[model samples]
Target: MFSSLKIRNYRLFATGAVVSNIGTWMSRVTQDWLVLSLTHSSAAVGITTALQFLPMLLFGLYGGVIVDRYPKRRLLLVTQGSMGFFGVVLAALTLSGHVQVWHVYLIAFFVGVVTVVDNPTRQSFVSEMVGPKQVRNAVSLNSANFQTARLVGPAVAGVLITSIGSGYAFLFNGLSFIAPLVGLTLMRPGELQKGHTVKRGKGQLREGLRYVKGRPELIAPIVLVGFVGTFGFNFPIWLTAFANTVFHGGAGMYSLFNILIAAGSLIGALLAARRRSTRLRLLIFAAASFGLLEVLVSFSPFVWLFCLVLVPVGMMGMTNNISANTTVQMAAEPAMRGRVMSLYMMVFVGGTPIGGPLLGWVTDTFGARVGFASGGAVTLIAALAIGFVLVRVIGVRPKMGLRNGMPYVELVPRPGSRAEGELASAA
Candidate 1:
């Protein structure tokens, strides 16, 4: 299960990343709370979130091209350092008592610009840290690592907010970046398994689009993740609204809600790490179930019950996350991996600029429950629609039955070579 941890370089990267990830989560929670404190409006918070993700929509494709052309480690150093610097500046502004909502928005926008490169770079970097054989396990472990941070960071930020201040949480997050920098510096260059970086050329960005446009296996998962990620992953907007508006609670309740989801996600990631296969059918089922759960949770009468509902929601959500990530990474050629992952992320995260504010508006206008239900409903509908297209239109055979005393999903192309050869494995 922990095979990726046996690799020396990957072990170092994971350790440092876990620490950094904790801080990242802390900053995210504090940022949202700080905005809400200033304006007392969910729309303001939504705008902040939107501004932060807007760069992805604008330059994400170009960022992918740059990542494919450059050395990922070097790019990470630049991007990560820039992010830490912004974290420190934001901290200073908050602590000095002169910070404004506009200031937070500006800093968040800068951070988003850095993330446009960092997201794809860091993802494709996993394949380098651990060889191809361990990519799936490494990716799952990374998701687990981030989820574990979510479990701790939000709760810690909540305590820090009530006890100290949000400024100090930002300060702590700024300092946390040092660990990952140190880890990157410590990695032995000789130990790295590097993929071939694409040479810069005209039309390269378009080349990537064409590549993804042709593969049903690839496009299928990307489309699924795009819908789910845009709509299904706006927890900050919904949960904050629920905690403050519905439950009449504070950061503690918000932290509790986040913690339950993280717990489920962590378990789900661990389970995904044990698997060697990434399948489209699994993606469909997990996403559909995740959406269905979110729809149900939106109607819960109590905060505690709502919190309990997040467990299965998080589990199914994380399963879809791992499966989709592994599918895109494994299916793409090494040379095009950066651009491919960038496109995957473009749809998955870039759409946040659109979804976040919409959800926040719904939460602000109708209520958190309605906002949550809308997102789930979109996700479920998309999954069913896409599944039908893949089965009936694209001739995908998603067969699930007992084989060798085990039930599995077999994804096969229509006979006579209509699509990619059998690509899925034991479900």
Candidate 2:
């Protein structure tokens, strides 16, 4: 399960990421809390969230293209450094009492721009560090590491906000980037995974679009993730609002909600790591289940009850995410992996910018309950639609195939004539 950590470079990266991710989560909590404290409006908080993620939606494809064309390691070093600087600037502004809503908006937008390039590079870089054989393990472990940080970071941020102030949380997050920078610099160049360098040309973006268009199974998962990510996974914003308005609590309750969700996510990541085969059918089922649970949780009358449901919600979410990630990576040709992963990142993160504010507006106009319910309903419908479409696209008959024995439609493709001939020859 922990086999991927045996790789020296990956271990270093993982360690640095764990430390850095904690700070990232810390800043996230504080940032939201600060916005709410200043504006006292859920819409303002939602706009802040949207600004932070909007760039990824707009420029993520180009970022992926750059990752495919350039040296990923060098790119990461630069991006990480830039993020640290941005964090420090925000911290300074907040500490000096010069911070305004517009300042926050601008800073969030800048960070989103940096993330457009950083996210795809980071995702593709993992395979280079651990190799294809350990890719699934590496991906699962990476998410586990992230969620573990989520569990620790929010609780710590809550305490710090209550004690020191939100500015200190930002300061800590700024400093946290140092670990990853040092780790990147320390990696032996000889130990790095060499990637295929694609030639830059006109229509490269169009080429990627066409590449995805050719694979319906691949397209199905991307669509499924886009829906779930945009609608169902607005927990960071929704939970914060819910805790404050509905539960009549503050940072502590927000932290508790994140902790419960992260607990379930950690379990989901561990289970995913143990799987020998990552299948698309599992992805669909997980996504569908997650959406359904979100709808159920929306109706909860108590904070504890809402938190309780997040366990299953988090579990299914992680399952869907890891399964989609592993399947996409495993199916793509090595030469096009960066491009495909970029599209995945674009759909996944980009959806948030579009969805966040819309959901926020719904919450503001109606109520958090209705807003959450609407998002969940959209996710459930999308998941079911994608599943049915994939069933037909993959040519999986209802009977006579091994898939019939399973519950959902698996994505593993059948052997072609040449592969069958090769098996006969070996026999």
Among the numbered candidates, top lDDT falls to 1
Which regions of candidate 1 fall more than 4 Å away from where they truly are? 398-412, 416-427
Give the per-residue lDDT digits (tens) of candidate 1, residues 54-98. 898888888899899998889888888888899899999989988
Query: Residue 382 CA error for candidate 2 (Å)?
Result: 0.6
Residue pair clashes in candidate 1: none
- Among all windows of ten consecutive residues in candidate 1, which has the lowest summed lDDT? 418-427
Report the lDDT tens digits of candidate 2 across residue range 216-306.
Answer: 5567778889998899888766887798888899899998898889999999999999987776678889988998998999999977789
Evaluate model 1: give its TM-score: 0.94
lDDT of every predicted structure (CA atoms) = 0.88, 0.85
Look at candidate 2 and tell me the lDDT of residue 9: 92
Clashes of each: 0, 0
